[model samples]
Target: MVDILRADARVGNKTYTSATVVIIGAGISGMCMAIDLIKRNNCHNFVILEKSSGVGGTWHDNKYPGCCCDVASILYSYSFEQYPKWSREYPGQEELLKYLIHVAEKYGLYKYIRFNSEAKEARWDEEEKKWRISVEVSGDKDSQFASSYILNSDFLASAVGQLNVPREPDIPGLKDFQGRMMHSARWDWTYNFENKRIAIIGNGATSAQIVPEVAKVASHLTVYQRTPNWVMPRLDTAVSPLQQALLTYVPPLRMRKRSLAMDFRESFYAAVSDAKSDFAQQIREWCVEGLRTQLANKPELWEKLTPNYSPGCKRLIISDDIYPALARENVDLETRRISRITETGIQIEGGTSQEYDLIVLATGFKTVEFMYPIQIYGSNGRPLSDIWKEGASAYHGVTVEDLPNFGMFYGPNTNLGHNSIILMIEAQSRYLNAILGEVLRARAKGKTLSVRPNPDALKRYNRELQEVLAKSSFADSNCSSWYKTEEGKITNNWSGTVVDYQRNLSQVRWSDYVVEGSAKGVVEPRKITHLGRVREESYMSNGSLILTAASVLAVVGGVLLRGSSLLRSR
Candidate 1:
């Protein structure tokens, strides 16, 4: 019920603004948080600051060709907000973007999103128990240096995912490439690849889709591969008009469709968790057979495209057209490592050289680096990056140990190899909403609060998670992948299924978090918990009373029945 926030002090003639909650990024995580805050909590004293001009986070930024989700559309979306009109099974980038826009509009989230506002620094103020957030506001032509503003907030939430920043490989003379250069993440759609000899570097997840799509139009295509990936056929199909109509008219059908899709995805978790499992071998064989069937005549090509590591070690690519595209006469697979990039072409090992009009860096983004470009200082001004110097680890993959009242979706070890992350995100948003509710109550009483997981608990949780991951294919594959850091630790994947994550985050364990607030020092701490909306003792008393009455009634009925039977026997 507390809506008022202490006003921000004026700095350099710029009036700073303060909100109850300041969510960073307008991506799926941020939007989900915003919607939960408004709809469930009926709290709206928040703002979502996005670096991009539009609402869709990655979908808004990466406008590359053949961009589509690896997960199915029905399950990839929020369970509460189902889209009845997904055009494809695995929707393309544009369609996905459109879906996001539709969701944002439907939820009336546009007014809450502040676009082109990039967060620069967020420092926790211990004394004030608030976050001093510095943001760079672009597109302000009237103001010099674009506009640097401070956002003071009672709580800070990060939906800024780890995958947007594109990384180019460290190849010598990469700058010397005089031909058209582009990254798959930062795709240049305007620059024509049609009728041009194009070379794609790094045959990973993004390249798996880009290669085949580009081959359909490029004059010639060459893929430079260091390590091959296991690619299974994508069961992609267009949604017929009848199906779309059924989904639109019969809303429950979407839930059923998502449940069926989830079942298919969940069945792969065993294969992902245990590399030596029968299902894992079957997955490997499926990839091998897929290659053999597509490149039957070109046995040599199959050998080159085959992966050397376990199937789930690296992210798998699902594309039906990849092998067929590679088998084309104009398409060439270069397994040899690149020696250097020339002005017009690339030189490979053994003195082999090739010319191409365009070079596509299909390299992926920094996955282990959480919240890059934004420096966050937690309690006591300890830098978040420094605290996570070894690797990023979070309790329940949502809250870190030192970061108080700051929650993140898709944090360390939350990325699922088998199931859709939307499921995980839904659970996380709900959990964070509970934490926010607690914060709001404290603020309503004119008190400050800082919330974080206990250090011992986080350490134990992460240790158990790492042990589980050790048996998973990602750790046993013996291949360097984006899932790990330079230390070769599995930091990007969850050791369990999405359902596991959901059940764990279904409710906030108030005892698990180390709470700090003004009420504890002088006044008694608030006995607030979401356990059936009643005190623990009260709930136990009601249950015990009901059980006692039931026991007495059963005893009386048994005596009466015994007496009647004795008389009848006589």
Candidate 2:
């Protein structure tokens, strides 16, 4: 793994910088992969290409008002480094970003990350058994011209998970009639909303969070909704100082809290995966009851806000303030189809129009397009765009068939509907680490190795995956979602529970893959000192078993009475 090669490449006069592995994106997935490589494999010959200036991927990109995670902080964070200092049940964007930065600094991952560097293209070189990656580096004040460089690596992995690219709706005359138009992801924080007549499009999770905050200042706000979603209460609460102290001192108590939160979140999988199950019925009832009680006086708004389709068809919106915000006298919920965008405002289908000073697009993202805009040339120089023309598909949402020795973090059919995505990312990191570790072991003996998923295995896995998903609420024809393609193929989200995905990817089955090449001379593998593992263990101080037992009883009693500050309701 330590074999570093540099050569004058054909593309410009620049030389190639080679590493054992080249990972794309420095988000949660990338950071976790780097940490596992050091902890589990004891490998440091890797480079992370981050397009942004910072490390916290989505959290860094999106800074809209009231932006917060719906999942509980305990389950949302990494398993190895559980955070006991979260200020709230559901963490806000700022807190989450700080946590990510803290983890990156603790692991010393900043040295491996190259900021302002975007991976443009990657081509597999069959003869050399390496991937030649082309990266575009944005010019800084010191540099006069932007430059490109070449990086060669034995293994290539994409940590560019879903939800990076913001989606701009194809509305007619949008560009012509735009009045201070901005997407929610790229919010203009400097712009003032006081006394401004605002129009926000889309009513998804992002919109739910933005409405309440924007409504407080806007003179009038119009929410254009094509379809209503099942909105549930967040029931968020702050963590008291006493609770934080208990969690900080009693490490075992924190462990139990996280375990309980994970199990509770995992149990909701049945409600999402099986739409007709008892769990689904119970959730639907709770949402309906909550909606009616919240909007009791304004009974007419209940019918307009309730969804006709089954629950879990699209992403669920969890908020306790959206209803009250929409009920404000200055706000209007427009259900009519948008005919077009005029110079001043949106034109309804009935030829009526309302002027607005600003338009905020809460449109979600290009989720189905995984690793898009990145030209990937796989085996025999086949372009990834042409290969996935129908829709993106991967074996267990990790390795592709033609893309040898390439693994993706959050690929197709890997997004969760009811559980934390951090779980899926951790599973993929471990799987890739296992595979890459073996490849390095073979390289020590002067052997070149290449591995790709078996064609039959890829076919069978996707077939079974889609078969199970077809019965889920996501496949309902009445609803359209980012989880599916334009052709109605369910390309995103797993078919089963989080536990199922973890168990399936627990170990790599060499039989399900086509492994090539053999080792030549008998050379001993490099002995790696497990210093990083020891350091990680030392970082988390554990108390004695007797003390931990006593603390658990005391902390558990207080948590039960105070309603478990770490847990939040849906």
Candidate 3:
């Protein structure tokens, strides 16, 4: 085994004006990747490129009423770093944003992040062994790149997730609508809905969140639902101060809580992956019973609210508030087909027209197109958009077949229906940390290295994944969701359990990839290092890149061990 740097070991806090590694976004995934690189890999020569004015990708962007995380707060947070004092079981967007900002502050990440810097294009520099990235920022429009900035790096990590981009439904006469309009993702906070007749369209997760809260305040809330979703009651409660005290005093207690939450969340795997299982049937009953119990007063709701398909066919919504809110006198749930947006209001298919002062499109994101509009040119000048013309895919939801020295966070087929995505991100971070260490280590040795998995390996991985997913409710059940591609392929989710993903990304199989260096052809990353001894992997050699000896620490598991956290999860 190659001697590697011990994870969690204290490394140099050096800063690089020009980064050797460039991360696309400063969101949760990007921050996690950067922290791992600096702390675990002992490399600090990286910068995060963020388009917004601050950190927090989805959390910062979405400030709509009742916007929050559905996953349990304790489990959703970073395992290694936990904020045990979360106010709720599931946190609101503001609280989540605060958590991300706190994480950045704790790790000293503000200096390394360039806010308002949006990546436009990335092209591989075959000769230079680097990526030439173009970015657009607030600058002189008449500049060299026409208001865009240039950044060059040896490696790139696309941490931009699929949910950020806002999409509107294509309805006839949309521009003719005279009322104020906005999408859920881009909620207009300044434009108040108080005493305003609000027509909220779409019934996805965002809609489910907004309807309940908006109904309480709006003069009249009209929700246009095309499909009914299987719902699970959320156990959201304020965290008691005593509980916070216990969590603060007892670190292991918080760990146990997180583990328990994860276990409970993971139980849904059967419902989504193996819909015919007993547990899946139990879940279906629970959803049905819960809806019936909540809407018992208005028994007529069973006809309007009940879904036709199975529970796990579509994304299972977790909300304890939706039923009561929709059942209110001022709230009207209309299942009629929307004909078009008129100058004053909406016209239903039954020739009925309802006028409203404002229209809130609860329509969710365009999730199938991963990293849209961001042009990434791989080897042989093949644009990533052209390659993913059919759909987006990756070897292990991280590395693409020909995108050498490039990786993505929250890429295709990586979204989870059963558990937290933060877990997947951490696993991928460690995996990428290993590869990044190898690449930079090689560069310090006066060698330029390029890395990517074999084409056959990537193909085999995705094919096996699709075959297994075909049996699941996500593919088998007839329901339209953000999970599928334009071609109706289940392209947005992981078919396997969270533990499975954790195990797969635990280690980077050196032989599975193809790597070459300028000075040394077929550069093998395997090296000589002793886990039981002391050494440093890389260091400054007279202000130039140079590989230093590896230093080891006495960890419970050996240094550079893969999937240690995954083992903890088990």
Give Cα-based local distance difference scores for all models: 0.82, 0.83, 0.81
Give the Å shift of residue 400 in candidate 2: 0.5
The residue ranges of model 1 lying beyond 4 angstroms of the native Cα positions read: 1-16, 140-146, 520-570
lDDT of 3 by residue, 1-570 (tens): 422222222222332224578899999999999898887776666778898888999999999999999998988788767898999999999999999999999998897787777899999988888898898875344234446657778899999998988888988888899989998878888897899999999987888899899998899989999999888889799999999887776554665677677777787888867767998788778888988888888888787888877666788899998988888999898998999999999999988999999999888887887887788899889898877877888988999877889999999899999889898888788888778787877776667889888888888898999998888888854677888875778888998878888878766677678786673353464532111211111223322321111111224236446567668778
Q: Once model 1 is optimally superposed onto the true structure by TM-score, how far is the C-alpha of residue 393 displaced, in angstroms?
A: 0.6
What pairs collide in candidate 2?
Answer: none
Candidate 2 — which residues are off by over 4 angstroms?
1-16, 142-146, 520-548, 551-570
**Better by lDDT, candidate 2 or 1:** 2
TM-score of each: 0.89, 0.89, 0.88
> Where is model 2 poorest over a 10-residue stretch in terms of lDDT?
529-538
The TM-score ranking, best first, is 2, 1, 3
Best by lDDT: 2
Would you list the rank order by lDDT, best first?
2, 1, 3
Local lDDT at 137 for model 2 = 86
lDDT of 2 by residue, 1-570 (tens): 423331111112232377778899999999999898888777777889998899999998999989999998867889888888899989999999999999999999998888889999999998888899998887484124447878988899999999999999888988877578899999888898889999999999999999999999999999999899988788888988888887787776777677667777778878776778898888889988988887776788888888876678888888989988987888899999998888899999989999999899899999988887789999999999877888999999999978888999999999988888988898889888887876677665667878798889999999999999899988888889999998989999899877788878876777677776564121123222121111111222335544757777887898796786556552
